[model samples]
Target: MHLHKINKVLICILLTYTVQYLMLPFPDLSAEEGVIFENPYKKTEKQTDVTQFTIYFTKKSHLIPKQDQVRLQSVADFLYRNRNFEILISAHSVEGKTNKENVLISEKRSLEVERFLLIHSVEPNQIRRLFYGNSKSPNLTKEHEALNRRVEILLQPIG
Candidate 1:
C-alpha cells in the first residue's frame, strides 16, 4: 500500500509539470519586429524632378526646432512647385528605450513633421508619415547615433 501511494504522488507531480510546460506561451523568436523600420517611406514607383530632404529629431523630446521647419518649408516649396510628387515621412529613434516608448516617440516626431508641413500649406493627402522608432540607425557612431533619431523625406512621383 505504501509503495502504491508513492507512485501515484510521483505520477501526479509529473503530469502537473507537463501541463504547465505545455500551457506556457512561446516567445516570438522570429524577426518580424526587426523589419518594421525598413523602408518606412513606402516610396512609390514614380519619377519626379523635385529634390528630397530629411529632418532629424536627435532626441526623445517633443520639441521641433526652427531650423527643422526651414528644411521642411524648403521641401514644401518643392512640393508646391511640383504638385505631382508625394512625400514619404519616415520617423526613426534610438535603440536604448523600450519598443513601446520608441514607437511612441517616433510617432510624435512624425506628427510634428506632418503638422509643420500642413501649417506651411502642404496638402495633408500629399504627405504620409512612417514611424520606425529605434529599429534602424542611420548613424552607427555612439555619439551620433542619436542623430539617427530623425525623419527622412522621400519624394516619389504621384499618379
Candidate 2:
C-alpha cells in the first residue's frame, strides 16, 4: 500500500514538471503584434516626391557620353521636379575576382557615377555613393556576370 502511494506521487510530480516545462516561454520569442515590415513599391505620403533611376555598366563602357548630355540632364530635371528626394548610388561587381581588384573596381564605378550626377547639377549633399564588388549579383554566369558589374541609383524620400 505504501509503495502504491509513492508511485502515484511520482507520476503526479512528473506530469506537473512536464506541463511546466511545456508552458515555459521561449528565449527568442517575438510578439506578432509588435512586428513591422516595410513595403518597397508602396509609396507613403512621406514618399510623395522621389524618383529613382539605375545605370548598369559593362566592361565595354563606363561613362555617360559627354556629347549626349540629355541623359544626365533628364536625371537632373527629374530630381528637381521631385520634393525632398535624394539619390543613392551603389556599384556592384561579380565574384571570381580578387578582393583587392574588386574593391578598386567598385570604388571607381561608384565615383564615376557620382561625378556624372554632380556634373549634371545634382547637389553633392543629395547624392550618396556605395560599392559592392563581386558581392551581390543577380545573374551568376561568367558572361552575364559582368552585367552585374554596374551602378544602381536609388531615389529616396527625405523628411
Candidate 3:
C-alpha cells in the first residue's frame, strides 16, 4: 500500500514537470514582446505629422486614382493599428456641374472611399460621410475645381 502511494506521487510530479517543460518556449501572456501583429504596410515614422490625406478624382468621375489607392492603403494600415481613431470623409464635386449631378457624383465619391476602408476592416461606425456637392470654390479655375473634386480624409481620436 505504501509503495503504491509513492508510485502515484511520483507519477503526478513527473506529469507536472513534463507539462511545464513543454510550455517553456511560448511567451507569457503579460510579456511585452513588441507588436503582437506584423503589418507589412507599417510606416517607420509616426503619422503625427499629418492627420489628413486626400484622394483626387477626374472631372465628373468618382474613380479613385491608382496612386491615391496606395496612399489610402497606408492610411488603412494606420487605422488598423490604432483602433481608437475614427475617420471623417468630406467629399466635394466640381463647381461648374449641375447641383443635382454634382450631388450624385459627390456621394458616389464618398461611398467609394468608404467602401475601400470598410473592405480593409474599418468598422462602419468609425466613419462619418459628408458631401458638399457644387460647393463654391474661392478660385473657379479648372485647376482649383479639379482640387475641389476630391475626398478629404481626416483621422481623429474618438474620445
Candidate 4:
C-alpha cells in the first residue's frame, strides 16, 4: 500500500511538471540592440559592404595552416589600413569533445589568430575574440563538421 502511494505521488509530480512544461511559451530570439550581425562567409546584398572574411582551421589544430597564412595576413593588413574598424574573431571548434575541452580548443584557436595578427602589426585594441566550443555546430553531417571548425573575422566600426 505504501509503495503504491509513493508511485502515485511520483506520477502526479511528473504529470504536473509535464503539463507546466507543455504550457510554457517559446523564448524570444530577437536581438535587444536591433543590430543583427550576418555570417561573414555568406554575404548577401544587405550584408555586403561589410568588411568581413573567414579563415578555416583543421580538426583539433589551433595553429593557422600554411595555406591559410596568406589569407590571415590579408586580414591583418586590412586592420593596419582601417584604423576605425575593429575585427571580431569568432572562433569555433567541432571535435565532439566535452564542453570544457571544446571551449579550450576554441580559445586556443582564437588566441593563435590574435597572436598572428599582432605579429603582422595589427593593433591589439582592434582585435576582439569570441570562442564558441562545439556548442554551435553548423550541421551534423561529417562534411559540415569541417565547416563548423573555423574562425570568422568581421570588421565593424568602433563605437
Instruction: Give the per-residue lDDT of model 4 (tens digit) for 75-157.
Output: 77878998888889988887746889889889998999899989999898998999998777676566567677788878888
Q: TM-scores across all candidates?
A: 0.60, 0.56, 0.64, 0.64
Clashing residue pairs for model 4: none
Best by lDDT: 4
Clash-forming residue pairs, model 3: none
Query: How do the candidates rank by lDDT, highest first?
Result: 4, 3, 1, 2
- After TM-score superposition, what is the CA distance of residue 53 in candidate 4 from its true location, in Å? 2.1
**Residue-wise C-alpha lDDT for candidate 1, range 68-116, written one tens digit per residue:** 5666677888777777877898888774468788888888888988888
lDDT of 2: 0.63
Per-residue lDDT of 49-103 in model 3, one digit per residue for the tens?
2368666677778888775676777777878888898889998886534888888
Per-residue alpha-carbon lDDT of candidate 2 for residues 1-159, written as tens digits (9 for 90 to 100):
999999999999999999997887895775563121232222322212224444455463456434223444666666666647777878777643586677677778788877877776777777788887777767676656645766776778765
TM-score of model 2 vs. true structure: 0.56
Q: What TM-score does structure 3 among the candidates reach?
A: 0.64
| Lowest lDDT 10-residue stretch of candidate 3 | 33-42
Flag regions of model 2 displaced more than 4 Å.
Answer: 1-50, 65-69, 81-83
> 20 in model 2: Cα distance from truth in Å?
91
Q: Each candidate: what lDDT?
A: 0.71, 0.63, 0.74, 0.76
